[model samples]
Target: MAGSVQPRQLALALPHAESLSRDDFLEGPANAAALSLVDSWPDWPNRIMLLAGPEGSGKSHLAAVWAGEAGARSTTAHALTAAAVPGALATGALVVEDLNPSGFDERALFHLMNLAREDQAFVLITARVPPAAFQVELRDLRSRLRAVPVVTLLPPDDRLFRALIVKFCADRQLSVDETVVSYLVTRIERSFAAARQAVELLDGEALRLGRPVTRALAAELLRDA
Candidate 1:
């Protein structure tokens, strides 16, 4: 018994955290600029504002916060069509997400931009890259997107990364320690996506093996990655 590992006694029900709300957002140096820009919306110098960031860099979460504040309707670039733009714009505040240059509808987006401007609607566009990098076939659309002010979300730093991991763990009701958090922060790549994946892998492994979340378990689960 002395040499054997002890199994953690977890609850029958998974821990439930509050829904993804603005209050849950952790604003540190990594995301403060982006957050500040988002907070300063409606008073933006330009009518169209672009939010760009790498995958899982909190762009969507921040967009959600903006949506709640402005009572905006949100959709992805692929889903935005010439036909759907009118209905989408009816919300007055609109968020068009993942507006990459490749495989996007330039005409539809151009139209949405024009409509948003005409209607005085506040538009928030999100993408993985800045609008300057997006390859727009339509010169008019290119010019339009280029004119939109851009805000970039930098990847999460250690503070934000650890906070995100803790939030992810709490969402799954996984009781992880500071040691595990600190361990994963150093071992894993510094990205929101990576943190989420690590937490997910550890949580699933712990549940499957009926073991507590430990440094050893984390090392085992993320060793290959």
Candidate 2:
């Protein structure tokens, strides 16, 4: 955040992209319900919320925003444990993205639920699919997951698609012309996830060329994609 330049211009430009903030995320029909749930936090009937959507549908983006706003903590389902909960969560909130994406750690999650409930802290979980559709091996965890409030996001629309590409370019200080942007939107994969991946590829190509993006390179990426 301080004295940082573009990643390609400087070998060490903050090293990693900044956390996805509220401004970086674009809202569309696919994301309105998820946005509303977070917007109505603490009054949304349940302090515990579950978010799931297609891969790269901005679930982690929303999770990070919520974590920042609430000063909440998080642990991937892989590393979560009971001892980890009710520590700093009571004063803030807790988010577990990709919950059971790898596999459900039922014992750890169940313990976390009890602790969060006791502490009156918020607990949010996210995955690529709804819990109902999650391929769970543990019956107890499956049953508990079904009871949680699940929010799903639709595939991103054009506005969201454009916004994500622009933000990616802006973040890297890469100057991409309107023609190139339009070309990417039209020829590249249209989903938010696809746009992000395409941007990364295009950004890397721009860095290698040490010049602004041109329609020619974009066309090549689209052609080769």
Candidate 3:
């Protein structure tokens, strides 16, 4: 009993809080137009607008920022129903997020759009692809969606990509220097999703091995990634 060896305990997978406040939103050429549209607010070109972009392009963050300013309600596309439209627009501002053709309720969305126009409530729809690409059975809904003004968020530029890696590391309370970030910029895919993934993997591995995050560590992990 006295010579018994103890098993090593793995670090717990704790959740980290991401800052989605307007100030925390990174600004760059990639998302300038999208940010401008969000900042313009009530002056939107139309009562209902669509924000489209590839995955991890900050559409949700921008929507949150706009929702905060507009005092809007947020709902997912799949969760929306015809009966829910009225309450969804009660705040006079609503964010219908992640609207894809796969599982969305067409009739419900159609009702919401018409109702929003009737009541002059502002609506922000965020999707990975443009509404025009949706394959809906409702012809009227398809036409209506195609007419909604769209603003697209592009992939981030080099500066913003580097900044994103650093910010993601900071969010996980992992202190990483420019060398690590610079090395990641070249090694990882040039996208927000990739930056977040790299940081998460690095954090998990560092905690597992009890090592500090460094360029060498990132090199090893990325080489295996």
Cα lDDT for residue 182, model 2? 90
Model 3 lDDT tens row, 66-105? 9999999999999999999999999999999999868788
lDDT (C-alpha) at residue 57 in model 3: 87
Return the TM-score for candidate 3, rounded to 2 decimals.
Answer: 0.96
- Give residue 164's error in model 3 in angstroms: 0.6
TM-score of each: 0.89, 0.85, 0.96
Which candidate achieves the best lDDT against the true structure? 3
Which lDDT values do the candidates have, in the order given? Answer: 0.84, 0.77, 0.92
Candidate scoring better on TM-score of 1 and 3: 3
Ranking by TM-score: 3, 1, 2
Q: In what order do the candidates fall by lDDT, top score first?
A: 3, 1, 2
Model 1 C-alpha lDDT versus the unseen true structure: 0.84
Off by over 4 Å in 1: 1-18
By summed lDDT, the worst window of 10 consecutive residues in model 2 runs over: 10-19
> Candidate 1 or 2, higher TM-score?
1
Clashing residue pairs, backbone N/CA/C < 3 A, model 1: none
In the range 124-201, model 2's lDDT, one tens digit per residue, is 888877778676666777787788989999887888877778877777777887888898888877776787778777
lDDT of model number 2 = 0.77
